[model samples]
Target: KTTTTSHPASISSTTRGLSAPTASHTRPTGPTGPSEPDPGPGSPFFFLWASPDNPYESESTTTSPPGMVVDNRIFEVLLSLPIWLMVYFCHSNVLDLYRKMPKSHKWAFPWLIHLAMGLAAVVSIVFGYARTHHIAPQDVTGNAFVGLNIISNSERIGLLIFAVVALGKIPETIRSLRSLVGRIAMEVMDIESIMDTTEILEVIASPMLLASATIIALTIRDLAKITDLLGSSSGVLLSLVLPGLVYAAIYSTPYLDIKDHDKRWNGHRLGGFSIATFGVGLGTIGFLATVFSW
Candidate 1:
């Protein structure tokens, strides 16, 4: 019976030889678990964030064809510009009128004018849609589209009201114009000099009213055509650009002593401009929609 004990160095060497081979064998296979990839350019998430394919890349992606979105937005803005300018001018005139009126008469007129304009706008919107869509009488009976028909009819009624109200103002407008002209004639000898602030405003108002009337008439005659026009690029330019130019001219005129002139330059003019811009945007959108539909 021999008692042979292994030396500490021999035992340690044996352990190291076995462990070194096992470690070397395992390392060549690389990681045992799924390894994470680098956040590279090829990554889908990275591409989505940085590339054009991503809808979230631009604000206009809510609509198709990024270029169209920009164009339509511009058109819609332009279309709405004139209305905004008219509103501003009307408001200024109303304020001037109120200031000249007795305290008892002031409150009613302002509210009335606002109501009239609002009614007119609502009517125009409704009638224009209804006439263009050509809603059938039978279609309204227990149909899903009935609501739209009703809305269209309601708009027509609103237009009627607006027209009535506008017509009603004719007498007052005439009186004011006459009085203004008389005052101008008494004050100055020259034709240009005779045209005082009020007379000049009246002149502007007359043309504005005539233009509005023509537009309204055209809209009434062929609302579909008007809608088509409004949805077109040219329509947007007419609605927005022309009006904006007119507003800019009026706003910049030193001779016109419109109240809050400075305030208008700072604030109200922006609103007018915004409306036109909105028209441009809408027109562009409409055009794109039409084109894509085809």
Candidate 2:
């Protein structure tokens, strides 16, 4: 009998009806290890590089109508509003930076910074829309192939630059986050008397605990869903609701001798109350939508 051999790609195509380089494709044996197929969602090592299925996609089936698609998109945008507001207005780093700036530098510098930030955000949105305008939302899930196929080299470079800028901010961001956390802890625990102890714990324990929790969260399969849930709920409260309430309370307070500001039912007071009311409705709907959709 004549010996016969088949190419791996041909064998896989014929036998499994799948193309080569799929998750089913086995690694070539090397000195380091035995041959194994690529790690998939079910693999023990999947968490390391796994991009979970789109939670929104799973909320609707492939047969969903155009109306349902529109509805889903609306809900997504609504939920995202809170997160965008959070980042733009009430982000810990931004607030911290504003607090540290001198009175002279505050007005002009902040206005310029915000102008640049707003322009950058608008440009990013436009760029993303231009690139992925042709792709269906359903088709744009977090799969690696989707990103690789859609993002051209120029777009990739832009993304890399943005990533670098983000990375550069990490140190300042960490300090801001730590300070915020310490302040919150102090307020909640009423630890004013034990200030030195609180400071020690905040310095020593907080980072380690936060890092550990972050690592644990990364290992979760549905991290995106959790993130959305958080963004819709706590993010809304912090960014929109609290700011509005605090503003109104400060202005409307009868006892406090707030200088250079009127403590009356003025436009500022009305605006603050309006924002708080809007936030209440937005947060409730967003949170409900996220939970129900998930």
Candidate 3:
């Protein structure tokens, strides 16, 4: 029998070949330590109303993110509109035609838009004094005014916009809508025809002052949590005087049988009063929740 002895070079080559296969076959180790997840758009609190089952959260890449900040947060947490409104008006091409119109009409649509914005800003400001600890009229005692959510001065501008640039054009808007829907062709209403200066002076402004006085009294202890609820507080107070006006106007409409109408108007006023009452209740609940959260 002829015995063959393996050379050291051949043995080393065989060992190297074996090691290569072993190295390639084994699984690679993943990153060490605790796994970190992506915080996602905006920040950790970006997705309020998060749903685990919602595919959109994981799959969809681009969408308007939910906000924790006041700028992106829904108005009083009831509805989201302001940010979208600002974005669309600022960047959208739908208003291109409006932009190209003659100087007078060019600003007509924009003026209406600005008025609505001003009203919303005013509502936010008036309510800010109530809901926010940082914005109270005068810090009385304790840490009641020192809230968890501290808004900056830039954010504070929302409070100031509406007070100066009010619309006072609710009547105009209603008539415009009626004409647009009811009539086949809408006529361009003149400035005088659109504005009821009489109602602005008589019907709206007086009660607005009254509502302001009442809300100021109520906001003494920061009980205005859901600010948007109080947005219509003034209107509700205004509505309180409307039924009496309806009663007064019934005599003028001689042909129409307004005995039932009078009862209906009474109910309408009661409904408005109830709504105003409920708004107060909501504001109180929200305030308690903010101050006394577990």
**What lDDT, from 0 to 1, does candidate 1 have?**
0.35
Cα lDDT tens digits, model 2, 62-96, are 22223422223532443354345445544545544
Candidate 3 structure quality by residue, lDDT tens digits, 62-131: 2112331233133233122333332233332333344355555533553444454444334333232222
On the 0 to 100 scale, the lDDT of residue 58 in model 3 is 31
Go through the candidates in order and give the C-alpha RMSD of each one to the true structure. 27.9, 15.5, 25.0
Which lDDT tens digits does candidate 1 get at residues 105-224? 643643443453343333333222221121212111111112244357788787668657755554454444344334334323334444465568677877886686587676556443
Worst 10 residues of 2 by lDDT: 12-21
Ordered from best to worst lDDT, the candidate numbers read: 2, 1, 3
Q: Count the backbone clashes (under 3 Å) in each candidate.
A: 32, 0, 0
Write down the RMSD of candidate 3 (Cα, Å).
25.0
Worst 10 residues of 1 by lDDT: 18-27
lDDT of 2: 0.39
Candidates 1 and 2 compared: the better one by lDDT is 2
